[model samples]
Every structure is written in C-alpha cells, then in structure tokens.
Target: MYRPKTTLEQWRILQAVVDHGGYAHAAEKLNKSQSSLNHAVAKLQSQLGVQLLEVRGRKAYLTEAGEVMLRRSRHLTQNVQDLESLAANIQQHWEPEITLAVDLAFPRSLLYPSLQQFLPECRGSRLKIIDTVITGTEEAITQGWADLVISHHVPKGHLGEVIAQVNFLLVCHPEHPLSQTSGPIDPNELSQHLQLVIADTSQSPDEKQGWLKSEARWTVSQFHTAVDLLLQGIGFCWLPEHVVQPHLADGLLKQLDLDGSSFRRLVSYLVKPRPDNIGPGSQLLYDLILSNRQVIRQDDNTATTGNNP
Candidate 1:
C-alpha cells in the first residue's frame, strides 16, 4: 500500500468504502467523521481527475473507475507481498535455475564443453539440460518443458532470433564404390547403394521418404550410430561438422559430391517468453553462445541432421 510520490491515503479510502460498503461505514472504520471521510474521497478524485463513487441519499456505491482502482490496488498489494518473498530468498543468495531442452544433434562434443567453461559467466546459476531431441525446440517452448532450445526449425511462437547457422553434408566410407565415382552423384543412382540414415523423431514424413530413396537402407536412431555404421563401410549418412571433425580427419569418412540437394540445415536459437530482466547467468550464457558462434561450420560433418527441405 506504500506509494512513492503519490499519497497512499487516497487508496486506503477507496479500499475502505469497497470493504465497508458505504461512506458512513468507511468513516467508522477509519475513526473519522463522515464529513472528513467525504472530503478525503473528494480530494482523491480531484487529484486523480477521476470519479470513484456515486452517492444517492443513504447509499454510496463505487463508480466503474473506483472498481477498477480497487482491483489494481489488490494486485499491487499482492506484488509487494511477492517482492518481499523474493527478496528474502535472494538475500540468502539463492541461485535461479533454468531447465533447457536440446536436440540430440546439439553438437554435444562442442556445446557441452563450452557450456561448462562459460557457465561461471552465467553468475552462479544452475542449468539442467533436458534431452528432448525428437520433440524439438518448438514443442519444448510451447509445452513449457524448456527455457531455451536449439534446432533447425524456428519455433512457431515467440521465436528468438536465429542466433547461428550450420549446414549438413553427405558422407560415406571412402573405399565404397560410390565414392570411386569422379563426378557428382545422382540421388536416383543411390537407390542401389547402401544408405545409412539417422532417423531422429524431429523428421517429417517427407524427410523419411527422401531417405527412402535408397533401396538398401540401414536405419540408426542416433547420429553417432549412423556415423559409426558409415565408417565401417556399411553406408553413407550426413553429419554435422562438430560431430564429424575428428572422424573426418582420421579418414573414417569422406564427403560425397551431390549434384542435386546440398542438404543444408539452419541452426536456430529458441527462447520462451521471459521477464524483462533476464538473470545475469542467462544473459552471460546467452552472450557466450553468441561469441563462440564462429564455430558454426558450413561443411557437413560425419553424421548430422538430415536436410529438412
């Protein structure tokens, strides 16, 4: 009920009438004469330039503005109570916690290291990373399961900006006969080759059908699994750069030249509706992620998310 520059007494008068039902009853509650209560109400109306009550003979009722003010007063009082509770917790240095969901394709090898190294910059807050690769960033935000997510698909509602971009490339065992071809390969020709695919839950029916272009197929649920399979000279799979860097260097997999689709994927940042004040930890973590974005590789790695389009 405390007002900074404005007097709180005026609000008290309004609440009193709302609670006591009439000006005379409010005067009794305030231990003031009826004329004193009347003058206080008039002074408040003049100051605010708004009517608060209507009086008819023995009856005094709140005007529409008065009712509106009463509701706002109640809300303001609750806000103060909440602030007090929050301050008490903060005075003890309670760390705010955030839960996040990330796709399995989150380039864990790189992202996890950076997250741990940069987390201190987030100012002592704790972060819980939830694994929800199939549900995707959009579903995580809408269902309130995560505060932030990363995926190729820009979340449908209140999407954060596309903080970074990365592309996927097709690769296979270097000794495979298909790799022996000198020129760009055709998608239809792949129908005869062994095609290893990482079938994540985020895939649409169309994406599934694209991989179906292969006559002989090996389906692996995770990207790493597909990468291993491809390395074993089993089949080819697209991979993200971070996940495939070491493998590509080791000559475990080789990139395939394609004439049709480049199979590029757009990595985006997604965040939920947040308070105006983003916590120090969140802001710091967000900035660090932004700074390290130069690592977004244009080349396709060993095993990666399939092309969405």
Candidate 2:
C-alpha cells in the first residue's frame, strides 16, 4: 500500500534527521519540537506504506528501506534548489544563450580562465562554441551564426583589437627528406615537395590561402588533420609553435632552418555589433575575455603561448 504524497518538506526533515543522527537532535537543529518531527516521519512512512524508522537504545535510526528513500530524497532536494536558482537567474534578465566563434589556430587554453570567471556571474546563460579556420571565423559573424569571434582574420571594415601574437614555425617529420637537406631550404626548394595546408573553411572553393602549388598539396579543414598527415612524413608546412612543441620535444618533428625572421601572426577579438541590444550575460563574457588577455600579458610569455590545455 505504498502511496507516498511526499513533499519537499518531508525530504528536508528526513535529511535533517540523518544529519543530526537522531529525531530529537534533528528537531533541535530544525527548531521544531521532537514530537512534531516524529509525527512527520511517521506520517511520511504511513503515506508511503514503508517503515522508515526504528528506535533502539533511546536513539532513532532509519530502517533499510528508509536509507534507500533518503538517498533519493537528497537528489530530489538538490534538483529543487537548482530549479529555484535558475528561476532567480532568469528573473535577472540574463541572456538565454550566446554563440562564440574561435579560430582553429587560437589557443583554447587561454579561453578557460575567461569562461571560469564568467560562470558565477552568468550562471543562467548557455554557451555554444564554434571553431573556425581563417576566413571561417569572419563568416561565422557575417552569416549571423556567432555572437563573438576570436581570430587572426576579421572581415574588412569590422573593428578588431589585437589580443595575442602566435608564432608559426615551418616544420616536418624528422624522417622527411627536407630534414636531410644541407643548406637553408628556400621557397623554390619547398615548392618541389608536397605542402600540407589547412583548407579554407569557406564553402566557396575559390577562396583559398597558403596553397603553395597545385601539383603537390594536401588540403584539410582542420589543423590537427594537417599535423597528423605531416607527422606521417607525407608533407611539410608551417604550424603554430604552441601546437607542435610536444612533437618537437619527442623528436617526432623538427623545424626547417629557413633564412628569414621568425614568422608570427597577430590575433584579435571581435564582438558582434548590436547597437540597439546586448544582453547582460553576453556583455559580462566579452568583458571577461578582455580581462583574461590583460591577465595573461602580465603573467608570462609561456602561459599565453601554448596548445589547448
């Protein structure tokens, strides 16, 4: 005859009883009379048709069935509290969702601090992240898909503020033929061999960058794909220093000694302009990004310049 009309208050009383280790102690903690606490537990057991308690040596203890129900009651109480918090957050005018587009080359490790800082202030908001390559980051905003973008290339006329500089190194597998070459490898020498390039993420086939030659090249949409193929001794190409440091240390990859200054690219942060409207949560996240950059700058070169953590 188990037909429990269990209220949240009953669950609270159960938890208090277990936490205080006896009915009388639990009643004292909850500021309720021991008789009222006992009545509530008895009523709960009767409604559920389960023996929830037993007294031995002047101490009230939970029965085997009570232990099982008590465990479930904890989760039910937590869920109820979470729902109430969510409702309060909603009432604060928090944005329901935000979309962030980041460049494939952009270091993902740098993003964590900003997100961690934003969580407490924007608990009610949901975030969607899109990883794009080169012009793809720009397209995400132009196509109305992203609310924010962090990339090296932004569309012309859109304002972007520089955040960090990423160093790109020309590298190849240690076993590759280029590693055997004697002198500083020049562009002409590089053109003769296969070049692994990250394909432009744009849908238009006509849009391409860094494609050295048509005769021998491998085009991929993701940088990791290019890295994987490069590791296989298929081709040689320039990749971010942060991304390839581990492979270099393991002697699986080596930098090609070229006669030139070190290659570096500047990356930027761009916020989608909505002159008329911007939600509080989205604004808080954007401000956090700026603050993260400042903190990283003050921190050290090694911390800001690394692969995804």
Candidate 3:
C-alpha cells in the first residue's frame, strides 16, 4: 500500500499559520512555540517538494501553489475533524445512522418540520427516511429494517404512541363524471367507476385501503402517480388532505360528495422497532414528533374546516 508523505497534523499546522496570519500569532493561539509551527510547515513543504508559504515583513502569505493546496487542505482538515466528532458521538451512544419508516398517509407538513429540527442537533448522525404504505410500514418495524417508524398500524408485539391523525379525503378531478353527480354520491355509483389506488410497498401486499368497492381499479406504487392519474380524470381515490390540498385549492381536484363520511381519519403512531436500544438521535426525533403533535392536529383541523384555527 502506498503511504502519504505528510500528516494531518502537519496540514493543520500549515492552515493555522495562514489563518492566524503568521507563525507567532498561530503559536500563541495554538499554545505552541513559534519555532515548532515553522518547523512543522517547513517539514510538510520539504516532504511535498513545494514551497507552500512566502515570508515577507512580519507576515507569511501563500504562494500560488500554497493557495490551491491550502483550499484542498482545509477540506481535508474539516473532514478529519468531522471524523473525530463522529467517533466521539459513537462512543457516547449516538447512532451513526438512524432509519425512519414513515407511512404514506402521514402529513408531510409535520414530517418535514420535525426532520428540519433534527438536522442540526443530530451531531453528525445520518437519517434514512423510508416512505412506506400500509403493510410496508409494519414490515419495516417487524423485520428490523428501521430504528423509528411512523405508521397507521403498530404490529402485534411492538408498542407505539399516537403521534398524528391524517385526514384521507376521497377526491376526483373537477371534470370527472363524479364531479357532475348531484347531491350525495351513492356507494353503488362509486363501485361502477375506476378507482386509483396506491399499491402496498411490501413483499406480500395486502388488500388496498378505502372504497375498494369498485371492480375496475388501477394501482400504482406511489402517491404522486396516483395524483397524476387522478388529475387526468381517470379515477377516484382517497388521498391525504395535505397531499391534495394545493390541487383542491387550485380546483384541479375536488372531494367527492359521498352519502356517508367524505373523509377518513387515520391515526399514525410513533414506534421504536428496537425500543430498548434506542439511541439519542432516534429519541431526539421521537421527542420532536411528540412535541409537534398538537401542531399537526391543528393543521389537520385547518385543512378539514377550510378556515385557519
């Protein structure tokens, strides 16, 4: 294996000398002798066969080569610092990465804000968000694929906290046959038309959710696809109010006037797949979701009522 001639310490010393303006100031800041700082930088330049710094008057400045190398070296030093921080975090029981499985029905309004809050406080930890539908969320929990899960269903053996309730509204394109129907739409009428459904993203897909009373159904893997199909006036399906809010507001989509309830409220839970071994990062995210649960509920109510609360 080929070895590097210079060390990270040497590069760091060079950066300090340039950042602090000269050897004397850098030594004072780093609590090292000026001669030692000069020696380290000199040794680095000698090993690389490059004159990295030019001394004039009482200050040191970078040469053309030194300017390019210093820019690259700053990145290298920052990476090393991050690596050390990651190692320290690992030692303190902070997870290096956390996998979060969220149900398709969950509100993006709530999920995104929680993630935004968690980003800065994660302490170098990485987040993996898995967008799951129906049985897919349950699979993520039971199969040990996720550290945190937000789903409509909490599997048999695991415990979950009710985090948010999403309103799934039955909707169709404004120009569709359903939109022209007068008064309360009959269930029999719904079964005659095609329904666009989101397919279960699991190994073993389960029965489709909502008014599957229709014999003619089109299934897709994602909500966006379903929304696209709905926009074409092709079919009708129950979609989360948040996902369809903009379309509804724009008159691109309209909620169907069903005889009974026009919307279904799905209560999503925050579950820990490995509760006993929950890391600080996962727990922090969990707490954030819980703290923001009320805000999610308020948003849901606002969406349903068409008035700000």
* Cα RMSD, model 3: 3.4
- Candidate 2's residue-wise lDDT over 117-172, tens digit each? 88877766789887877667768756756767887776665666565667788889
TM-score quality measure for candidate 3: 0.91
lDDT of 1: 0.66
lDDT of 3 by residue, 89-188 (tens): 9999999999998898887777777788998999989888889999888899998789999989888999988766778989999999999999999999
Native-to-model Cα distance after best TM-score fit, residue 2 in candidate 2, in Å: 14
Clashing residue pairs in candidate 2 are: none
The lDDT for every candidate, in the order shown, is 0.66, 0.76, 0.87
Which of candidates 1 and 3 is the stronger one according to lDDT?
3
| lDDT head-to-head 2 vs 3, winner | 3
lDDT string for model 1 (1-309, tens) is 966543567677777877898888888989988887788888888877888888877877788888897788777766666567556546754435766676666655435555866655544456888665444445665556555666556545555644455557788888988789888888777778877765545433225223457778777777888887777888777677667767778988888887776665756564643524445455556555554543333465432322221
The residue ranges of model 3 lying beyond 4 angstroms of the native Cα positions read 295-309
Tell me each candidate's TM-score: 0.55, 0.80, 0.91
- lDDT of residue 212 for candidate 1: 56
Measured with C-alpha atoms, the lDDT of residue 155 in candidate 3 is 83
Q: After TM-score superposition, what is the CA distance of residue 298 in candidate 2 from its true location, in Å?
A: 14
